[model samples]
Each structure stands twice: as C-alpha cells, then as structure tokens.
Target: MTLFTDIGALVASAIGGMQADGILPGGLDLGPVTVEPPRDAGHGDMATNAAMVLAKPAGKKPRDIAEALAPRLAADPRVASAEVAGPGFINLRLETSVWQEVPRAVIAAGTGYGRSTMGGGRKVNVEYVSANPTGPLHVGHTRGAVFGDALASLLDFAGWDVTREYYINDGGAQVDVLARSVYLRYLEAHGQEVEFADGTYPGEYLIAVGEALKAEVGDAYMGKPEAEWLEAVRSFATDAMMELIREDLKLLGVRMDHFFSEKSLYGTGRIESAIDTLKSKDLIYRGTLEPPKGKTPEDWEPREQTLFRSTAHGDDVDRPIMKSDGAWTYFAPDIAYHWDKVSRGYDALIDVFGADHGGYVKRMKAAVSALSDGRVPLDIKLCQLVKLYKDGEPFKMSKRAGTFVTLRDVVDEVGPDVTRFVMLTRKNDAPLDFDFGKVLEQSKENPVFYVQYAHARVHSVLRKARDAGLDVSDTALAGADVAQLDHEAELAVAKKLAEWPRLVEIAAKGHEPHRVAFFLYDLASDFHALWNRGNDQPELRFLQEDQPATSAAKIALARAVSVVISAGLGILGVAPVEEMR
Candidate 1:
C-alpha cells in the first residue's frame, strides 16, 4: 500500500471520529481533501488540507477543525507529531519506522511496486502514429509513437485494459501518389528510364518496391495505361510500405495490438453505417459552410454538400462529410473510424496526433461525442516536433526518407532505449531538441544517463556487498533490520521511494507518461544525492565493512531504488542497464 494513501486514510479516520464526537458537521465532502508532502521539509513529513476544505461546509473555523483533528491523528502510533500549520493544514511527521517500511514494501513488490488498480479495468484504446502508408516513419511520427506506446503502458500499469492501435491512412490520395512512385521504380527495373513528376514520391526507398513489382510480374504493366495498373500497383505499394513501417516500429520497441486500415472502411458500408448512426441523431444534413475566418482562399466557393452538424457537439462549426460529387470527404472516414472505436465498447478513446493535426482536435472530439452520444470520453494529445542536432549543429536529413530524418536513423545512432527515454524528456506538446552528442554523455545533465547510472550504481553496491559475504538478495533484504537506516540522508531516499505509487496513479490519470520520466529523474537525483553523501560519511555508505546487519539495511534501501528505477524505465519502454558502457 502507498504511504500517502495510507496516511490519507488515517486522516479520514480522524475526521470521522471528529464527526462522531460532534466537533464538526457530518456528511462533509472530503473529495478535495488531500494528504501530501509538505512544501517545506522542516515543516513536517506530510500535510493535509482536510480542515481547510471542510471549514466552509461545516461552518467552522479551519483552525477549530484542525486543532480538534490534530489530537486524534497524533494518537496513532505511526504519527510522531500532528501539528496544525498555517491557517488550517495539519502537518504530520510520521515515525521513522513508517518511512523505513518503504524499502521493505518495495523489496516485497519488486517491479510491481507502483502498479495500481486506479482504472478499475476499464477499456481504453490508444491510437497513435497513424502516418500515411508512405515510405518510412520520420522523427515526427517517432514522437507520437513513443508517446502513445508509453501512454498505453502507463494505463496498463494503472490497471486499465488498454489496446495499442495504429490507424493506417491508406485511403487518401497519398497512397495513390505512393503507387505512382512505385510504378516509376517498376519501370526503371524494366530498364526504361522514368522521371518522377512533382506529385509522385522520389525517395530512394521506392526503388526496392519497384524491383519487387518487376519480380512479381515481369513487364506485365510495362506499357499499360494508368487505369489498367493503378489499382494493382496501389495495393502492392501500400502493403510494401506498411511492412516497412512495421519494421521501423519494431526497431523502436513498439508493437501495435491492431492496425485499422482506412481503405477497409471504404466500400465496406462502414462509413455509411457510421454516418447513418449520426444521421439518426440529426447530426447529418445538407449545408454550405461560411468562408473561413482568415484570408479567404483563392479557390473558395460556396457549394452545397453533405455536412455534419459538429457544432451541436461543441465544434466551432458544421463540417463537410461528403462532396457534391458524391465522394466522401476526408472527415467522413475519420468520423466512421472513431465511431467504429466507440462501437467496440471502449469506455475511453485517446488519439495521439502530431502537432500539425492540432486543427482536427475539436472536430474529431465533436464527432466522437455525437457518435458515442457522450457516453465515452475522448482525449487527443498533440506531440510537437523534434529537432535533431549533432555536435551542436542541425543533424542531416535521411537520404532514404528524402525529406526528413527517419526513425531508423535516430534509433540506429542512439539505441532504442536512449531514443525512447530522450524522446519523453519533454512534454508531448513541447518542442524537443534532441542533441545526439548530449544524450550519450555520462553526466547529470543527461537525464537518461543519470537515471541509468543510478541503477547501475545500486547493482555495484549489491555486488560489493555480495563479495564481502553479505546476503543482499531481495528475499534477504526484505527481512533486513531496516531500523538501522535512521540517517536523515538514507530516510530521504526512502521518502522519495514512497512517492512512486502516488506518482503512477497521477501520471496515468493525466495521460502523461512524460511525468513518469520526470519522476524517475527526480528519484534518481535523490538516490544520487544519498550516494554522494555516502562518500563523505562512512556510516552513510551502503556496504559497511564489519557490520553485516547495517550493510543489509543500507543495501535494502539501495535495492529499492533500483527496483523503482527499473519499473519506471519499463513504463517508458526502456531497458535498465546494469553497467553503463
């Protein structure tokens, strides 16, 4: 159990006693009440805002409630002192024994230490990296992939039944461009020179696809008309591109539970069914949208079209779902796809989109709301761009991707663990400057290296203790007499360890896996601080010669830090290194 939550329960129990004794009114809402660490360490170990939140409702002064509650809380053996601080907050200093139990609890739980049941096993589908079936995934798509995968793992750790999904955008005109590009490569394989036009892809990656097509059908469509070979080439090209995308994802340690094809929704009545579901609710209609607010486009023209009344569900205005030519608009398939997700019985839906798709957020949310009838919640996270640098200069572009840096380029330079960890060092919506030179440095400035170094140091401590004939296994450490870990520096690390469960629940609830990375960094900082302090104080060291019991106690604390670091790294899809090279 989490120490914060356990202390919160104790605070609630004390308030309940106050209500029983008629010191305060009954039936007060304690939802806003929280027990967390005090802002100032000298104030107390933990602080609660129960009195401040209850003052208005109970019609009693905050100090009156806090003064009455303090005695009841101080009565518990676990509480060393329960002092009323400031106006109403009750600051509690728990017994040192309470903090010592953190290491023991961590040792007992192992990698599962911070896992929670906060989700209650609700279903959530996280769709990310739905880049078009173009060549390889670029750095922009890489950020979305890492964010979405980490979010899914975070939700799973918080006890949600999560499905990791990728929406293949193969139904658009881009795939047709891809097909034409591959046809050029196919023609080149037949020894006929072909020049790539403005609209077709000219990336070097398409060369292999062209040769493969030539291998499959020798010169069959060599001089055929566009219509005669367009469909065949499109199918073949998209499959090949999707295979390339899958390989890129696999290299980054990302695996999708499902890949929903946009092409599958077309001609399968899925789009019609989804629109019909909305039409039944009067969300579909015939209309013409007003000119957009900014400078009117040169092609701007008012034309009657099939529109979705997205404003009814909080969109800025109605959106077109079908063109006058009876062809489905780009929005139609997206609406249908989200409707498909809603129809799958998910309690929640999350889309991880690149920053360029920021404009689609409100409309997509409106579509899901109208389709799900507001039963399911939808959250769309936008991942900003990643700018690569090497030696403090802008990194070069990938020759294979032609226009941008590919995911493979980054992962190949720095391993997947480094790529994933460094990608999450910033918030999803913030621009990240990935410096190839800095991330590999073995210094505190590099978060990935610093955090991994802490873990490695713990193993070093364990190894030294083992060589000294000390039993430092997790089983032995769990039963260690941790009362010897009474130093303030040692207990400081234990306090940080106690924050793990609460931090996990908070990060999962907020759909911010970056918070996990930040927390791990802070935890590593605390661990490193203790390790550095040990250098000056012999008794503060983890492996105390001629004192096996004290060494076990200190090593148990070190092992707990490693456990938490490993668990946090796992959530970020990073492998913890035992020794840094």
Candidate 2:
C-alpha cells in the first residue's frame, strides 16, 4: 500500500529483467536502488537512481543501463512513460489510471494506507520529556513532549514496537528542595509563617500539595523535627508534582507508557552493576580531568575522581561517574537506566532531550554503546525552544510558575489538537515561533486548520453524495469509472497521495515526525489547487450534476486526499475536523 516501494520494486523489476537478458551484467545487485520524487518535479513524477546507483558496481554505463531498462518499465501497464534523463536518471510518469485508483485505495485503507513494516517489528525505546518532577512542565517541556509523542506515533506507523517513556528525576537534590518547599507550605497550612528560601521552589502549583498534606496529616508534623518529616514530605510532594505534570501532559494529549523513577535506580545495586560492567571493559577509571578547554570554571580543581572514559566511544572527554567524596554523579543513574533499556533487548534507543541538555548527548550515547556492545544504536533528538506569541506579542509567564510559562497554560488556551499540530509544523531541532493568532487563523497560513479543512471538505462531499442516493461508500467508490480522473490537476493530487507510504518510511527512519506535517501541507496544497480549478472548469468539479458515474470517479480523488490528511493528522495526535467551526 506504500506507493513508493511498489514503484521502486517495479523499477527494480525492470532492471532485473535487463540483468536476466544480459543487457545488465548477471548477478548485478540492485539493492542500492532508489525511486523517489525528483527534487524538482519538472524532471518527472518520480526519479529513480537505479541505473546510476548500480552503474559502478555492475561496470556498465549508467545511461546505457537506463536506456536498456526504460523500455521494460514503460511496458508495465501502470507506467505511462519512463525516459532516461540527464546522466541515467530514469524519470517515470505513471499512467493516469494509476493515480485515479489511489483514492479508492485510500478509501479502502482508511488511515492505514501509509503504514509500513519497515522496522520489521523491532523494539524501539523512545525516552522523552524526562523533565525533573519538581514542578509543573513548562513551555520547553511542552515542545519536547509534543515532539516525542508524535515521533513515537510515526515510528509505530512504521512498524516499531515503540515504548514512550518518561524518566523521573525523583532521586535528585531538587526533590529534597520539593520536600523543604512543601514543608514550608505545610507550616503555612498549620497557620505558621514560613519563608521560601533562595534554593526552594516558589511556584504556586505547590499550594494544592500543601493543602493535600494538611488533609492527609493535619498538624501531625507541625512541630516535628526535620528527620521525622523530611522522608514522608518528600514522597508526598513528589507524587503531587508528578500528578500535576501528568495532568499537564494529558492536556496536550500526551501519555507515557512508562514513568521510570530515578529512585528505583538507587538502593538496587543496578548502578553498581552498570559501572562494574564498564569497569570490566576498562571504561571506568579513577583520574583527574583536565580543566575544560578555552576557559576553566571557577570551581575547577585537580582531584582524583571515578571517571568514565566516554571519549573512547566518541565523547569530547572522559566524564565523571563518581565525585571525589564517593558520591555517584548524576550521570551514574543515567548509565544504569540505559543499561536497563539494553537489557530489555531493544534494537534502538532514542532519547528526546531539551536543547539545554545538548551537553549530555555524547556521554549518554557512549554509555548505551558500551552497555549494548555497540549492538544497539542510540539517537538523541534535541528539541529547541518554542516562543509562544499572542497577537504579535510574546506571551507572558504565569505568575504561578514563577519565571516560566506552564504547559497547561498553552494547552488550555489552545485545544490539544491545535497545540500538538502547530508544535510539529517545524522541525524538532529548529526553534519554532508558535503564534496564537496565526495558528488559529482560518486561512492557509494556519496549517492545522488548512489540513483539517481539507478533511472536512471531503466529509461534506460524502454527505452530499450520500443524500443523492449514490452508493458512495468505500466499496461503491472503489468500483467507480476511475478512468474519468484524467485531468492533470486531479492526477497531481493523486501523486501526492501516493507519496504517503514513502514519507512515513523516511520520517520514521530519521525519527523526525515533522516531515509528516510538511508532507500534509504539500498534499493539502495540491488538493486545494484542484478544488480551486473546479471554479473555472466544471468538468473538473468533484460532483457531476445527476451523473453518478463521473461523480464517483472524481469524488474518489477527493476522498483519497482526505484519507491522507487524516492519516497525517492522526500521526501528529491531531483530530481531524468534520466541519470547520
């Protein structure tokens, strides 16, 4: 159902025939072949590199091979033409009937038309939005969350057994700060004046946790020693913060498959085991790191520490795993967590980190590489910042979050569908300006509404066709006189529809879900262009006055476009609108 491969396989078939006929060398492998849309559509519908890609290996001239292969490809009933262009690139023009059938395929397939089995059912662990569980998720975490969730969905569509995971920083000093902050709030609940110190969190979101603590243990620890209250308060505050964060994520339509606690990595000997494994490989060593390059930090001092030789696996320098005082560094738990992922037998590990954490990427990759013996590849995707704008003005932070804008603030103002779609309209690593007014705009400038409107229009056509007493259901539409869909405009939309399966494969392979958003925009443009042409060309219209045969054929093309838009929106976690409201 992925048209890209079907077309590529056809091209492969042609080259294969040439090989069999001795025009191409016998046993000349064509595995490196590729059939993709030409960078410039002026070249053709699709451009294949089979001849050129196979030339050097087969010891044959690329143009000679293309000339011999072109005829066999053109002979296929679905191919309208196959001409060798500059240097042996075979540009293929598919038959008009081939495009007319795409809509029927989409109507029959629903959102599953572009789904691929490219991953071969391999397990992939996508760990994202592991924001510290000390406070509510902010705008930065929102971008990371949407990017991760959409990427996971894209991989799932491409046949990865993907697990969307979150790592809780419940083991850090920050949680202790959460404990102290909540304790201060607890005293306030008991009517005692307390102050939020310099290092303590001052966010108002903890107010509810204070009230909850008062409800759970009213005045029980009002005058108790720090020892008697810290443990219980720490656990209570972490749970509350996690609950708040979960709600924030839910507002944006994000749900994690796993909420891994850093506390679990402690007291379990797992960290020791991971370090021991690295030590066994001589990757763990006790040494003094040289002062960082360019300028030394003020705290820089020469001292022996347990260092991980990460540079051996591609890091800039060896990293510290344990402090001189014998306490494990924050990186220790990370190593253990990835070792756990490796033990779970995942074929790949992908961590979606905020851009601020760009410094940690190499060490994390080294750890996973060592733990998995380089068998499991790790790809770390860093999501840049999202600057929220409202009416050409930068959005202000919530006083409640104290210097930050909360994710819920964004999601509450814009629906989850709009929030998710707009966030993904840009690449994950690229900084995105999310304008509240622009995203809500009804015109083509608003990609979310534009794509959704395309789907809604298709539904409108279906409603019209249904009342006309035509069998416009998928089964009936698939049997329409598809040959009537011969117009260049109609065929252009169908060609875009055919690219869906291939787009999914490429996007999933790169762990870039933004490609889906971009592809949807292009497909919608094609659909809209055709719809506009119908204003001047009545025969190109989706509906034919009292002519069911012609109507079904044209409607099939429109339905196919909608099917793709819906599928793309589904991958982005955006719900398609049945009608523009």
lDDT of 1: 0.93
lDDT of 2 at 489: 92
lDDT of 2 by residue, 27-53 (tens): 766678898999998877888998898
- Candidate 2, pairs of clashing residues: none
Q: How close is candidate 2 to the true structure, as a TM-score?
A: 0.97
Least well predicted 10-residue stretch by lDDT in candidate 2: 395-404
Q: Which candidate leads the pack in lDDT? A: 1
lDDT of 1 at 176: 88
Which stretches in model 2 have alpha-carbon errors above 4 Å?
26-29, 296-300
Question: What TM-score would every model get versus the actual structure?
Answer: 0.97, 0.97
User: What is the lDDT for 155 in model 1?
Assistant: 100
In terms of TM-score, the best-performing candidate is 1
Output the lDDT of residue 76, model 1: 96
